[model samples]
Target chain A: MNAMTDRIAGVLVLPQPYVLFLGDTTVPGFAKTAFGLRDWAADKCVGELRLPGATVTTGLEALTAAEAHARGARALVIGVANLGGVIPANWRASLVEALEAGLDLIAGMHMRLADIPELAEAAHRLGRQLIDVRVPPPQIPVGTGRKRSGKRLLTVGTDCALGKKYTALALARAFERRGIDSDFRASGQTGIMIAGGGIAMDAVVSDFEAGAAELLSPDAAPGHWDIIEGQGALTHPAYAAVSLGLLHGSQPDVFVVCHEPGRTEMLGTAGYKLTSVEEIVELTLLLGRRTNPAIRCGGFAFNTSALGEAAATELMARESARLGLPVADPVRGGPAFDVLVDSCLA
Target chain B: MNAMTDRIAGVLVLPQPYVLFLGDTTVPGFAKTAFGLRDWAADKCVGELRLPGATVTTGLEALTAAEAHARGARALVIGVANLGGVIPANWRASLVEALEAGLDLIAGMHMRLADIPELAEAAHRLGRQLIDVRVPPPQIPVGTGRKRSGKRLLTVGTDCALGKKYTALALARAFERRGIDSDFRASGQTGIMIAGGGIAMDAVVSDFEAGAAELLSPDAAPGHWDIIEGQGALTHPAYAAVSLGLLHGSQPDVFVVCHEPGRTEMLGTAGYKLTSVEEIVELTLLLGRRTNPAIRCGGFAFNTSALGEAAATELMARESARLGLPVADPVRGGPAFDVLVDSCLA
Candidate 1:
């Protein structure tokens, strides 16, 4: 049995929830899964999870997610893209433990945890909720290959870990603050969990990847903005297919090109330089215009975390003037969005 | 019941076989399937085919592929990518008729005709044969991400109808004539039936699309060329995924870019001008080198069918000189093969 030793790092400003993880993340084989859970669930996580040989960090105790609520834990997350997405039999007992504790189960894997008969029965009996992150929403309409009403924007990044999701969220919030109707549409596991109703694009089959996106970004009311969380970069080799699918599927009316201020190399390629902002915008329009010739790149959403406040602000201003579009660090502050809205949105 | 009427249009130089077409291909709905049969089976077909409303064309009779064989027909072809790849139940009777005549059935759809129990049992009882064109061979190994021996080539086109398959076949035949040990790897329906042993690349699921290519072009014997037939153009919107998958999966050592002489836009896109032969080469190499940096575009393979013989030859020569590589219309005879071999085939 794996137990946790708690060490609280700082005084919690917001009430942090505990989450019981369901993988033996201490082992090298499952470490990546454990790390991913830690990174993605950093916000709510307060206690350790129930898994064999799990290493508990952040001074959180390990308990089943069901029982974690008693210790301030809110959701049980099974974080892993396992082979065939199956949960081994040995893990079933712990799931039952979580269920008995009435923990909400959040499964980010392709395998639907709710499909397990025993777990489903136990959850039902205990009145526990089970969220399958990868299951696509039903009633996704087929793409009409025609322009629709309102404006949609996708946060496309130069590389993974460049904060496309953060920008999308920031933009959605900004639109709301500005008295505009807006929605944040997630396309990945983290985004799905955050939005509470979106498909994990990576887990979807290729044929339906686009279909799922289409479902997520259904036609919005006039003057509303749909800020879609984009998936992989177009330059990524293993992921380019999914990226293109999402682009074609969403048919965004406006585009938000996200990028890191200092990074220069592509993530997966062998020392391949990152495409310039100008080139990426042109490439995106070239492909997007195949479906909607009127589709245009609205502006840049730069992640200026690596730069000082003054430097980031100055750089954003310079680029804004040069590109003649809205350029901003949406999470912090910038001016890239106004021109973008004026150019693409009526 | 469908019947055939024979018409002898001209003196037949080649021994052609009669086939009983299953569906009423002459009708509006099934006409596409019927048309495919006419296209792919042109060389081996005799007078006509058997179908409910099939009309005798060019004085040829209509009969079942099976019954036609009995009357000197060679094979039965299911010539359509039917909805859900299903052969209509009423058509089964015609399949039965073909089985009675001992005709070998060729299925080109995602659905395997042999998988239907009734058809399977009937074929078995009558000792007839069923050929599934889309099934990947068993025991295909996973890609190791390691470089393998043997120089390989793939014919990538500007668009679908630009004769990539035609160029691949021409180059392979040309290599054989040069006493080179090489093989033609098929990746589409027409190429599959022609080779008699290849998977329909487009019908495959996205995950295994690359795996199929890897399986087909396993480490070859020293000094032999693996000329792979490519599917779809990278510039095509709907078809780009399959095309990219083939590119990534095959990991070819050499690129043979194919294009038509006068084609201006992508087949299915809205006013999308074809990227130049030069840019395509650069893009192909950029993507190809993601997996294998040593990968290079050997030269261009132009389909100059629209031009006169003299014009075609002159254009080929000019491009060859301009691109400084072997440029050719292998089907119509050119020097492209020689330069391609010299540049790529060590």
Candidate 2:
């Protein structure tokens, strides 16, 4: 039987009232239900974890590590909904013991993992064995039987809350109205497909990288290409193990990115800082070049409401000329962005 | 010297780093030189206070009550910056004694106040007044030599982070481009104006009426009219107080409100019983109505990106019909939004 030793300092005994468990079959079945329901439950669960004056711990304590392995339970899923404010040091120890006892971690919400160094250390000790579970980006689920024949377009953005989803949805609606086939999928969500199981792999890998980076060099900037790439490589094994668990049923053709003008300047939030409109256009070109060199990039769309349309249009034109790609201003009263995208794909 | 009685609890301290003393000099030179660096340094000389952590206290011992007072402090120039978390309770008694012993309550970032029920009772026994400082809604700053002539437009969102600031900035830029002058201000910054010496009396009266309704009957469906009137009134006291400070410098013409969609649904971070979108919209419209009636209502601007142009247009139209005021959809592609507002305002 697993024993609680004094070495485990942050032994947070979750109030019995809040602890919940779903059997293996039952859990997967619930996830298979409506996507909105799944997302809603996931968001609710995360919210519960964020409540103040509550301590939560998840793992198989009664069974030995060997027994857990026999039952196909390689890791414990520690769900952290929020990581704001001060986290006690004792809690850190419990987290370490849980991971050492073969528990993996999954955090929901925008968490500052760097704030907790102990968790990172525990993750490093576990190496490639740990897994992070996050929501799958809003993409067309597999087996829906939707087929794409015309230019299958996909749009991405520089960061969350930068009007990426709205722009993508708008583009999709615009394309559908025009009878052009298109798909919407975020890069993190796509990474899940690449990681195997139906589970979204990008968020997990992102976490692993963040954890490892914090342990190794806490000061290193997060969401940076180098850190992200390293985390992806390190978590590849866990991802492969769960490959069957994560499956991407659909794919898109042309990928378009909603470019935020001042992304580069904002370090931890989006990844880079944005100095000028030219920088946003250039960043899009660079992303296309680095991610998929052969895929012809369909122009850039700016959040004109945030950045003036005139300024955005001027910058796009300058960047398009320099990069040899078509640019479109999706802002109302300006040229139709959808028309430009369709023409480019054609 | 004042002696510490055992009745003190936690203290809520408001530390002001700088204070600009405005004497009887209207001359720019005298205003600038009167409050030499020494006057500002006086804040640091104020000794720290110790208070209890449990229960509510009154007078100097009651931190929350004291803070409520400082929030409405007039005839004094104090600025708070870089405050650490609230002070612990242990220091409350000592701090209170110090304050009573001729230690002027100069502002600093780490002011401590106590919150013990016993201390509150003691203050009551002594007949020390406990007044709830009224806070106001957002308004533009005065003395920048800018005036609102044609219209004083303000954009607010149904929820925070709903792209209100971006949209407002966009509209401002658009108006500037079209040779139509406008002023831009954030609500939070405007709320701070009260400390800078503005008093909006009309807004305060409205908030009082609304606060009374809320206190009288607390129910789920308190009706839109009541809630909106309350919010307008509640926010008005603070808004008016700040505006009073600003009016001492300049004036503006019409006031515009960039309508935010929902309130309770988005404002409350924690999970609560779900409320329908219709209910939220109703409440928002009510708030708009009450606020518009009280102020020189200019026009309305909707956040069309989240709530599509169609829904936003419909909502604006309904508001116009109900209040007989003009509304604008600054968002490009919004149907009949701009035209309606322009025509109505003209």
Candidate 3:
């Protein structure tokens, strides 16, 4: 295999049939990976493994590491998405136990699982892999902005952690349901775990962010579509670089602005206000045009988990009317969502 | 010192009063580091060391490793900014000789100097340092976009390797001449070597790029000016992420668009075209406004080396008239350059 293919293969190689380890996480947001795998890649997950004092559950059958391994699970995937993506000192013993249970320890944390001495020693002795999905593949080429054949739809956002990945996932599913050739392209840790393969764009070196994005979605059949999960918003103070790089490299023919209504301030940044959908559409087009001049906004995807059904419906309607674009909560899966899907194909 | 301060200190620690090593490069463009040191940091650079087959001259006294060491040169700074920032296999023997002559080896290459086995062994045996300025300091916090108390001027470019760093350096010098409280902030490898203590923004992880830029030019006295060197252009396919991150983090109050007069295609990329000065100016203002709402374009700095003295002058005047902004070739300092400097202050 060529070097790029080899590196991609190496990065994507993970022991499968996972027992999701949801470490003492009470908040659903913190347990996003466990929940994501349960919802999206349910077939690959054998069961859920919760630590003592854990208050959150993915609703998967609870199983011990040894039990899961006996049931044909090959890996224990760390399913927590903490603030810093760290492996806390309190969780070392539990991780080590999994390694000793004959299951590879898979993590999407910023800190590698092998960096923990106890887990590392146990994994080494037990001949288990410590797969770090968050680590970027080596030697990503600089982006060339060379256009590739195929259709692409990128889910951009006003603030991060809204629903860009979910929108992409839902769109990909919808496209598949319609017998359209489509694939979900992940760009973050949780999404990487869900898709089983993707470059964690944020983890890459700044110089190679676009290149990594390009690698994530390569040339495909002319009728095929790659629905790419986006990173930070164009208005994000810290992460716009990753967002722009993804936008340029993905060269999406259609983009959907994902946003959370009623979010006055941007995530983690107090003084920075969230960008409006109109502003996001304008900026994404202005910047994305450098790579694909034919790029256009397909619609808007609202994360309405915080709103009631009536309120969310009203908001989507208002936004759609004001912006003259289809808007919907993909999870709601109504006629509105159907229109949004049609917009993507259009 | 705190961790941030400690890391910065570690990154900036380099043996000074050096011999600049221009490798077997005949092209002046490839010998930019040698010329930059000879022209800007002349006092710190004691002499030049040229390898066999090198035709480039920095107009400094030529010295061998032993002679340069005897003359109190503490390090041999790699003075070639060659493509890929790599040390050629043929250059290993000459590098090893420098280590043997009791000098620390300093390089601003993509590959670390210590990674070379022969140089590493010699440096270890001689108890000399192998300084790699291309490595970013660890633990850069995510950019908060919290407004700082200093003025900043960033020199943005239409393409890479086209006078952005030189323009920023010249502008910093000009600001100093006017008794303005100012410092030149480096964002790339060569700039880091020249300035001795600035973050290599492009080398930083994509998630921390803006944060690294923020650390490069932190909060200063209200009147202080931090003249930040720009990285890739916003229109650049491969590296716009680095450019946008620096633009947002530096929060420049005034920006100068640096460009070459007649370049059609972008650097390195075959099919990608150059961004117009007007487009650059517009985009710089549009994106730069995220961090600093009052951001404005200062003027333009052109790389007029490809043109004759008269042609360069005529083009500068005509372009200045058309764009209605101060335009000059900073290398060819004249009334136009003085006006350009005035625009920055204004």
Q: Which numbered prediction scores highest in lDDT against the true structure?
A: 3
* Fnat of all models, as shown: 0.09, 0.00, 0.81
lDDT minimum window of 10 residues, candidate 3 chain B: B1-10
Question: Candidate 2 on A20-102: residue-level lDDT in tens?
Answer: 11112122323221122123123212111112333332221334333443444434333322224233454455446545756
Residue B85, model 3: Cα distance from true site in angstroms: 4.6
Most accurate candidate by DockQ: 3
What is the Å distance of residue B190 in model 1 from its true position?
A: 3.3
lDDT of 3 at B262: 91
**What is the clash tally of candidate 3?**
0
DockQ of 3: 0.80
lDDT of 2 by residue, B206-298 (tens): 112222211211222211111011111101111211122121111212333444555333332222222332332332333222222223334
DockQ for all candidate structures vs. native:
0.13, 0.01, 0.80
User: Which DockQ-derived CAPRI band holds candidate 2?
Assistant: incorrect
lDDT of 2: 0.32
Candidates 1 and 3 compared: the better one by DockQ is 3
